[model samples]
Target chain A: EPEVTQTPSHQVTQMGQEVILRCVPISNHLYFYWYRQILGQKVEFLVSFYNNEISEKSEIFDDQFSVERPDGSNFTLKIRSTKLEDSAMYFCASSEARGAGEKLFFGSGTQLSVL
Target chain B: AQTVTQSQPEMSVQEAETVTLSCTYDTSESNYYLFWYKQPPSRQMILVIRQEAYKQQNATENRFSVNFQKAAKSFSLKISDSQLGDTAMYFCAFMVNYQLIWGAGTKLIIKP
Candidate 1:
């Protein structure tokens, strides 16, 4: 079974620093997404990308955040300036289609800690 | 606004027993998809089961099954012959358009 892989399983940075989280989606997947889960909270959608551009984003995804599929296989999320509230487990997910019924495959998650 | 609710915050069951996790959602759209995702300590989201609103027949996968009540807006997951591996935080999600609206989640503990 193909899986989504995220590098730097854990990341630590100062509150004002910049951070980039990387994800390699499944080879055949066409749609990609970024989600975050604060400790002890429900998962929140951040952004979804397809065809090398953003399809939709949540209010939580603001000017400070951006996503790029710089290549055919790698999707990355960059935070221009991280805040303490940005500390959370960031998850990368991908699916073969954008249908409501399509199941997404998620990565193990990158735990980002903004000190 | 659409919301998914998992009333139970946590539950525990002895191994080999059957356990049920409750979920409900509020939505006006007639067509949508409901899903159960399991997250163990690894924090990986794994799909457990899915139900389509238009399908009257419930969806089942091995020992995992769902009792989906479309009119009532209820979708519950039932784990039969539960094992310790089945222990995890389960999230119920409602898929509309291309996005998934998630519930807070229910933490399930399977004790040996």
Candidate 2:
């Protein structure tokens, strides 16, 4: 089965540094998303991208965060300034459609550690 | 506002036995989607099963089945003949208004 792929399974960076996480969604998927799970916390949606722009974003997705599908296949999330609280497993997901019950395929996740 | 809740934080079951994971949600939308996702130690989110709120019948996929009580606002997963591989963190999610609300998750341990 086709799967979403993410680069740099793990990343370690100092607070106040910039970090970018990359994901390659399934080729045919139209909707892409980014979710983060803090240690021992529920997964939280950061943003959803469609047609090269953001369709929706959560309150947690503030000014310091940005997402870009630079290419037809590559979706990236950039954190302008990392904080210790930003340490979490960031997962990239993609779905084939936009309607209700659209099942998503998720990547193994990028573990971001801020020191 | 909508929310998904999994009351049990941990559960254990013997291999080849059966187990059930409970999930409840608060939603006012008449048409929505409910789903169960499994996350192993690898941290990969795996789609386990899905149930549409309008459907009266339960959804099943092989050994994985869901008892969805829309009026009761409850959805539970029943794993039959559970295997060691079934051990994972299970999350119940409610899909509404273009957002997916997730539960804290229940950690299932399959004893061998």
Candidate 3:
């Protein structure tokens, strides 16, 4: 089965530093999303991308966060300046389309630790 | 906005026994999708089962099944003859308006 793949399985960055998390969604998927989970917390949606633009974003996806489909197969999330609270597991997911019952395939996730 | 709730924070069942995890959601949309995902120690998200709100019949995958009550806004997962590998954290989620909303999650332990 085809699955979403993410690069940099684990990353450690200092406060005020920048970090980029990359994902390669399933080839045929049309919708891509970024979600984060703080330790012992719920999985929170950060942003959703479709048609080369952001479709929707949550409050957690603030000014410092940006997502790009930089290439045909690469989707990336960049944080301008990482904060200590930004430490968490970032997951990339993709769905075939906007169908009513479509399911998302998620990557193993990148563990970001900010010091 | 849609919200998913998994009331049970933690639960445990003996191997070979049955276990049920409860989930509820608040949504006004007539058409949506519900899903149950499992995260083991590896922290990789795995789809367990899914149900379309428009369908009345429950969805089942082998030993895993769901009881989806659209009227009550309830969706529960049942694991039959559980095995040690079934131990993991389970999350109930809903898809609405092209967005995914997830619950806090329920930690399940299958004791040998």
Candidate 4:
């Protein structure tokens, strides 16, 4: 089955540096999302994208966070300045539609470590 | 706001035995969806099962099944004939109002 794919399975960056996580959603998917899970914490939603725009975002998605669909297949999440607290497992997910019962396919996730 | 709660932090079961993971949620929306996802050591989130709130019948997928009580806002996962590969962190999630709410998670260990 086709699945969402993310690059840089693991990333290590210095604090105050910029980091960009990349994801290639399923070719036919229309909606994409980003979620994060701090070690030992529940997965938290960051943002959702559709039609090349952000549909929804959580409070944690503040000024430092932004998402872009630079190309038809690539979706990227950029953090202007990283912090220790930003270290977590970042996951990319996509869905064929926005239906209530539709399932979202998730990638293996990129583990972000800030030094 | 919608919140999903998986009270059990961890659980264990012997191979071939059965185990059930409990999940409850607080959602005001009547129409929604519930899902169980498994995160193995690799940290890959895999969808295990799903249930639509409007459906009365429980959803089952091979050895995995769900006891979805929509009125009580409870959803539980039951794994039958468990295998060592079943050992993973299970998360119960709910989708409502176009957003997904996740539970803390239950770490399940299947011993051989």
Candidate 5:
């Protein structure tokens, strides 16, 4: 079975620096999402993308954050200025459709460490 | 706002035994979706099972099953014949109006 893939499984960056976490969602998926989980905490939704536009975003997804498909197969989340609070496991997920019962397939996650 | 709650923070069960994890949610929407995701040490969120609000019958997959009570806003997962591989952090999530609400998760340990 095909799975979502994320690159640079672990990222270390200084505060106030820019960082882009990349994801290659399932080849046939139509909806993409980004979620963050602080160590030992609940996973919080960041943003959702579809049809080349942001379908929805949580309050945590502020002006400093942005997402782009950039290409047919890649979805990237960019944080303009990283903060210590930004350290977390970022997961990228995709679904064939946004149906009520459809389950999103998730990547292994990129552990971002903001120093 | 929709909120999912998993009251149990951690639990342990012997292999070959059964374990049930509880979950509850607060939602105003009549139609929505519920899911159980298991994340092992790898931290990859794997879909274990799903339940739709309108469905009367519970969703089941192999040893994993759900007991969904929409009226009570409760959805629980029961794992039968639990194995070592079943040990993981289990999260209960709610989907409504295109938003996914996640619970804190219950850390389940399967002892040999």
Candidate 6:
């Protein structure tokens, strides 16, 4: 089975620094999403990207957060100014279709630690 | 606003035994989807099963099955003949308009 690949399995960054998380979704997948899970908390949706633009985003996604599908292959999430609260496991997922019941393929999340 | 609830925070069962994980959700939309995802120690999220709200028949995989009650708004997962590999954190999710609302998750431990 195809899988979504995320780079830098573990990232440690200083507070107020910029950090870019990269992901390579499956070759044929069309829809992409970003979700984060704080320790002991439920997963929270950040944003969804399709057709080179954001389809929907959660309140957790604010001005400091931005997503880009550069070169039609790598989908990147950039946090201009990281905060201590930004520490969490970020997962990248992709689906072949946008159907209501389609399955999503997720990467082995990138754990980000902001100090 | 939609929310999924997993009543059991953790459960344990002997290998080859059967285990059931409970999940309930709240939503106003009539048409939607429900999903079960398992995250192993590796932290990789894998799809276990899914059900479409419009479908009356329950969905089943090899050793995983769901008891879906539409009117009651409940979706529970049953794992029969459990194995050690089945140990993971299971999350129940509700989906509508391509957005998934997740639950706090239930941790299942399969002991040999």
Judging by DockQ against the true structure, name the best candidate: 6
Candidate 6 accuracy as lDDT: 0.95
DockQ of each: 0.83, 0.87, 0.69, 0.79, 0.79, 0.89
- Deviation (Å) of B91 in candidate 6: 0.5
Q: Which consecutive 10 residues in model 5 chain B have the weakest lDDT in total?
A: B93-102
> Of the pair 1 and 6, which is ahead by TM-score?
6
lDDT of 2 by residue, B1-112 (tens): 6889999999999999999999999998999999999999988899999999999999999999999988899999999999999999999998887778999999999999
Model 5 lDDT per residue over B1-112, tens place: 6899999999999999999999999998989999999999987899999999999999999999999999999999999999999989999998876767899999999999
lDDT by residue (tens digit), candidate 3, B1-112: 5788999999999999999999999998988899999989877788999999999999999999999999999999999999999999999999876777899999999999
Cα RMSD to native, each candidate?
1.0, 0.9, 1.5, 1.1, 1.0, 0.8
lDDT of each: 0.94, 0.95, 0.93, 0.94, 0.94, 0.95
* Candidate 4 Cα misplacement greater than 4 A, ranges: none
TM-score (C-alpha) between model 5 and the true structure: 0.97
**Candidate 5 segments exceeding 4 Å error:** none
Candidate 2, A39: how far from true, in Å? 1.0
lDDT by residue (tens digit), candidate 2, A9-101? 999999999999999999999999999999988899999999999999999999999999998899999999999999999999999999789
Q: What tens-digit string does per-residue lDDT give for candidate 1 at A2-113?
A: 8999988999999999999999999999999999999878788999999988999999999999999888889999999999999999999999999989999999999999
TM-score of model 4 relative to the true fold?
A: 0.96
Residue pairs with colliding backbones in model 6 are none
Score every model by TM-score. Answer: 0.97, 0.98, 0.94, 0.96, 0.97, 0.98
Summarize candidate 6's per-residue lDDT along B1-112 as a digit string, tens digits. 6899999999999999999999999999999999999999988899999999999999999999999999999999999999999999999998877888999999999999
Where does model 3 exceed 4 Å of error? none
How good is the docking of model 5, as DockQ? 0.79
